[model samples]
Target: MEPEKLRKRINELAAKKKKEGLSETEEVERAALRAEFLANFRQAFRSQVEMMQVFDKAGKEVTPEKVREIQRKKGLRDD
Candidate 1:
């Protein structure tokens, strides 16, 4: 599902829960949607972080070691 749609549904479910609560089926659906949204968000965030480059003063590359290691494993950078 698209991110926006997933987000919208999650919000709708949240509002519904706050106002009237959900049936068992709707509760299950909400759980599934929330899990899916989290998975997608984490993947997008990881991709963004992996593609990032950091620099310090004097033009030195200062990307974190953990991120550099991830980039190396993904073949996005050279060791």
Candidate 2:
């Protein structure tokens, strides 16, 4: 689902939990939704980081080896 909708549902569940306790099914649904949200966030973050390139003041590329390796595997960078 969209991030905003996911966030809204999670927040709603959280508010419900804080005000009135949730049933067993609601608790399970909340956990699953939270896990899904985290997975989506991690994937988006990883994609962003994989596409990033860092340069030093002297214009030397300073991206980390792990990130460079990922870029190389994806044919996004040379050397």
Candidate 3:
């Protein structure tokens, strides 16, 4: 294709996108939702960190492998 044709096509698409109105209110709503999501994520992250600290200080490692071993030793597996 010609360079001028490509430029015209690009400009047309840009204009169309601009006309579609990706709104400021929508952006503000998205930011508010994201802030709430991040706050919840941080809370959960801190809780997990605290849980790990307690597990470490209490001298117990809550690993899947350890749970599996305990289950095996106790004959707790149905299969």
Candidate 4:
């Protein structure tokens, strides 16, 4: 689902919960929507992290080897 719509439904369910509460089906739907939201958030964050470069005060790179390896595998690094 689109992120905006997903959030809208989640917020609606939360407000309903605070007011009158949800049925069992709505509870399940809310859980699934939240999980999907978190997964999408994590994926976007991981991509941002992967494309980053880290440096030290002396201009030498101090990026972790694991991150470098991922960059290389994705063709982001030539060295």
Name the best candidate (by TM-score). Answer: 4
TM-score of each: 0.86, 0.91, 0.41, 0.95
Q: Could you give candidate 4's per-residue lDDT for residues 1-79 as a string of tens digits?
A: 9999999999999999999999999999999999999999999999999999999999999988999999999999998
Model 2: per-residue lDDT, tens digit, 1-79?
Answer: 8889999999999999999989999999999999999999999999999999999999998999999999999999877
Q: Tell me the tens digit of each residue's lDDT in model 1 across 10-59.
A: 99999999999999999999999999999998999989999999998888
lDDT of 3 by residue, 12-39 (tens): 5456557885457655654555556567
- In candidate 1, stretches whose alpha carbon ends up further than 4 angstroms from where it belongs are none
In model 2, which range of ten residues has the least summed lDDT?
70-79
Given candidate 4, what's the lDDT at residue 42? Answer: 99
Off by over 4 Å in 3: 1-21, 54-79
Candidate 1 lDDT (Cα, whole model)?
0.94
TM-score of 4: 0.95
lDDT for model 4, please: 0.97
Quick one: ranking by TM-score, best first? 4, 2, 1, 3
lDDT scores for all predictions?
0.94, 0.96, 0.54, 0.97
Candidate 4 weakest ten by summed lDDT: 60-69
Q: Give per-residue lDDT, candidate 2, residue 28.
A: 98
Task: List ranges where model 2 is wrong by over 4 Å.
Answer: none
Check candidate 4 and list the clashing pairs. Answer: none
| Shift in Å, residue 61, candidate 4 | 1.3
Cα-based lDDT at residue 59, candidate 3:
77
Q: After superposition, how far is residue 17 of candidate 4 from its true place, in Å?
A: 0.5
